[model samples]
Target: MSNVEHVTFKNRDMYWEIAADIYYPPNFDESKQYPAIVVAHPIGSCKEQTSGEVYSAQLAEQGFVALAFDASFQGESGGEPRFTEDPSLRVEDFRHVADYLVTLSYVDAGRIGLIGICGGGGYAINAAMTERRYKAIATITGANYGRVLRETEGSAEAVIAKLEEIAAQRTAEAQGADWQVDGGLPESTEQAKELGITDVDILGATEYYKTTRGAKPNGLNKTLRSHMGTAYGWDAFHLAEELLTQPLLVVVGDIQGGFGAYRDGYEIVRRARSTKKELTVVKGWSHYDLYDKDEPVAQAMSKLTPFFTENL
Candidate 1:
């Protein structure tokens, strides 16, 4: 019923195959090259879970060549120590996708763009900084993973201390203890409840991550290798000093828990020397609103099409 077609392409390594769904425009022309957009999913989620397919399908109907693929070590991609998370490798995965995109006869290499959702947004920005392959980058309900994990909501020093503790845990695992990562969301203490983050936050996130709404068996979260910190160490703000030459778009929902991060990122980009950037805060939308069938999805696409159309 949709214009999208399932496809698979081999990465540089034979074992690292990219599983993607290509959405063709209803009026697609075989002889014409089209602007291409690569959609990346969130950490611990697949191309399917966060509705990357839905976005691609919709973009295709709008006359773009949109491709959504699973990151290596997640979903249909092949990697060892399955479910493991690596920031550098994830960024490389995006680069590889860009490389693959340029090879497509129907793709216009100069017009390639990227859209990252949730955690993937962080990866995409980082990728743009180093990859320079994407002509434009856009993020929805974006997150800066390194900042979120290393710096807590209140105090940076206190958050770093906690990260050091997590590092110690990784050390213990390397020395042969079972790799015991946090199972689910932490139990909400009384103090947390006072802050309005009752048990509901944990429970809701768990349900979202563990159900069909946002779950993939192979997309389960796993502890990073002990050395992974070296790659994910730099906060998203670290790159703020560098000029964002390409057009950047940041989209956030008003009600998401991590909405503040979106603002933080936008401010950083605004400070950059780049003149081509825009930010949109969707009112009455929650964190998960951009993930699936929420009204904000339509609002996001409406804004995204024009931005990429003009920029890419």
Candidate 2:
């Protein structure tokens, strides 16, 4: 196994700092430049919480330079109103990472690629729409953040109403009404348990977000800014359709009921006039199965190594 080093860089006019872990292959040589992959972590989670860091380590062992990063406003990165999620800024963050990577003597600037997990996958595809420098892109168990925000578990009208309520809370806070947001998990009820949420998928997501599994001491589950809602504005489908010049690889668990995102994104890539694309579906795997399991992780890495090796 090769040693991985933790590092940080600045972005967004230096108003923000991005934290990352760089994995160097055994007997790494500065004299020889290598293909590089930027690995982005899941939404509401830091680099270390998800499998982004682990996957980067494996990529390093396979003789590639892999850098896993904590997105802006999360993890060790600098951003106001901690834990606030912004899709546009997230996409720009990926571009900034590519800019930072190309400056390193050990990185092959022309051969840079990206690997995004979960929510990060959507941002990666969104970034590729404008960041042509990225030669290849890959995603695992990905989610289209915009779609989820607009349609998951609630109707569009209902979601808008909830957003409005949050905004009102923010207004009250600005008026110094002694407003305080809950910094912990939502309580589980028997009704939730009957929905197959034995642990944290449905009811436990609240707990998971508040605990060490996905939470940081400075992170927040609620934001006071109304513009935060606007972050989910762009259509990932449109982004995929427009940015099909680069080679892409989409991987998903076939049994996961939420594979629609992967299917839709892959179809866009396949229809592109200039891009070459491939899709891999793992049998009997669920949404979170690829997060840390060794078998699925290994299979994903195997597919990733060859795809980037050939395209990037």
Candidate 3:
């Protein structure tokens, strides 16, 4: 069984509390200081989903202290304007997790590492850009939400129009109208197809986030409509070419489309200044496969286990 302990701590820059699940290594000893890895969940996901149930659980078994946490404004974390997806705040959440980890006597602060999945991958990279506490960083199916939205929103004019709409929505909310939200995946592949979504990655997201396979009570897959403006204005790898110097490991599926995680993985690795970096492209696997698929997850762990072990 995974030795997980539920905990909560206040955010570094914000008044909200962050809820998290810490997974201890087998034969865990509080008297001993262990290297720690902060695990961040994907956008619209929580600690109880793949981040805690799969990745953190597996990492703990591999002999590292693993932490899976919900970002502020999501899951059990305390934040206002619920379900907002602000990348800047999300990046700051990682720093807050690091702050909490460093205070624990059992965690070796200098040897701290990071692992982020999907959108969390983007945030992790962004966090490591300035937070030098993380000695090494890794991402599975890493996705840059801003880049994806910019490229996929059809055209520059279309994107600008969408942002204008988002602005109007925010004004409406401020004027006492209810907060309109969007970006939730469909309940099933059939529904997704009916909605004109045929991308393999999005279809796979439906399979994972909408079903019992990866679904959790706290992972409802919604984001505030107004938050899209912030997401659209941000970039996860804004200064990675200069500031991202930690050892990097990028794991992604070979699948070509859906949300561009595959593309983002290669792009970030190229942009990062990390001298020691490697990108492992899992053959024949799609973006969502790495989320909870046994074979891909195991395959990713094979690279991840050694990467952290050597770097941290």
Q: What is the C-alpha lDDT of each candidate?
A: 0.72, 0.71, 0.92
- 271 in model 2: Cα distance from truth in Å? 5.4
Report each candidate's C-alpha RMSD, comma-separated, in the order given. 3.8, 3.6, 1.2
lDDT (tens digit, per residue) of candidate 2 on 184-258:
234434545555555323343454455455555533445335445654455555645555578888888765343
Worst lDDT run of 10 residues, candidate 3, spans: 181-190
lDDT of candidate model 2 versus the reference: 0.71
Query: CA shift at 70, candidate 2, in angstroms?
Result: 0.7
CA shift of 53, model 3, Å: 1.0
Q: Where does candidate 3 stray beyond 4 Å? A: none
Residue lDDT tens for model 1, 21-133: 77788878768899989998877777776646567777777788998888886688877555666777787888778878888888989999898887788788878877777
Alpha-carbon TM-score of each model against the true structure: 0.84, 0.85, 0.98
lDDT of 3 by residue, 1-312 (tens): 349999999985789899999999999999999999999999989999888889999999999999999999999999989999999889889889999999999999899999999999999999999999999999999999898888878889989999999999989899999988785788787899999987898899899888888878898889999777989878999999999999999999998776899889999999999999999999989988898999999999999999999999
lDDT leader: 3
Ranking by TM-score: 3, 2, 1
